[model samples]
Target: MSFAEPSRIEPDDNQSRGIALAILLLPLTLPLFLFLCLFVFLPVGLFAFLFSFTGELLFYLSMWNDGRTLTRRRLRRRLAAGETGTLIIEYPMLAQGRTHAWWTPDDISTLAPLPIPDRSSDEYQDAVLDLMEQDQSHPWDAWCWQEYTSTSQGKASLLRVWNGKKYQEWLARHYPSIPIVETTSEIVRQLEIEAQQKSHQPQP
Candidate 1:
């Protein structure tokens, strides 16, 4: 949370004109926006997502951006009520389905989820690591660049490689002091136990 005073963008002094303009525009733009979202986007998106990885990224990115919007909205409401303190939000990492705890000040700042490519995809190595869209410096601590795969039982599993290309530069640049701690042995043990328990269960 930034202690700096929030910049106020004063609305038009003539409220009636603004209201009239909105009234005029709503009938024209609302339907068009809805049309694009429903007919054009949804219809095409359903098939595109199944056929192309690029489409999958676009769809998920939109959802992540929407999440950021909600986060910002909640932060604004809190700030408006004279709340000030460190704000920590827990979220799943963009690169993988794992917990990521964000510890930062109680400002309205938001981190948009990164568009990380799937580890098995050809573009994984070429994936851009830029965070310029958020208009803030990279918060390296907020990122978890692990890969995930489905286990035999359809459960999610995390795979963090110490020398994974996607995260090598990110680790060195942001988290120099924090030693790498993510490992798979514990997860492997957990999965093995789960398998054994399943095997012991009576068959239907």
Candidate 2:
């Protein structure tokens, strides 16, 4: 929950003439700035209006499935608290977000890819800005995950990143406990082998 001393991320307001602006101006600017992700699941949220429990259940289930050995919220939260685990993920992409895999701690279990949108796009920038404007805030990864949950991602993922130098530096400084590796064909191959081995084991 604690952040680095700087906690440098601040909400951006390119239009900060006065507070009165939001009362009237936000509606005017909103349509121009709204991104695809915001409205993409508009109906889903409407559906939740009828059965909110179903939406909450799906979101939590998504979190648990993506957790270590299939439980908890996220791997990085543990790493943030100084827990050690080799956190494997798709090779960091310049634009698109990356899928994640965290297995038996120093030991691993599942391997799969989750689809995500490009982080470097204008749509993403606007989406993040809109989320921040609403005071929907969390640490970077958690914030992104919150956005991801709104859509069909919950149906596919237990789980699901940024640029190279900036992204790597951020991860290293923020989470030093885990060895975060980009996936290579060889690494993916090994995980596949492990999955096959586990599949043959007697079920508890």
* Tens-digit lDDT string for candidate 2 (1-204): 996786576645755546666777888787756654376566677776656455435644655655413323454576556665444443322224433432224422122233333445576456645655664422333322222222222221232211223434445677654454433122223334566789999999
**Candidate 2, after superposition: displacement of residue 171 in Å?**
3.3
List pairs with backbone clashes in candidate 2. Answer: 66-158, 98-161, 103-108, 104-108
In every candidate, how many clashes are there? 3, 4
Top candidate (lDDT): 2
Global lDDT scores for all candidate models: 0.38, 0.42
Q: Pick the candidate with the highest TM-score.
A: 2
lDDT of 1 by residue, 1-204 (tens): 669889998877799798999999999999999999999999898876566555434534543444422233453465467544322222222244332222123222233244422333444322223332332222222232111111222111121222233333343464443222221122333445666899999999
TM-score of each: 0.23, 0.25
lDDT of 2: 0.42
Which segments of model 1 are wrong by more than 4 Å? 1-13, 52-94, 97-204
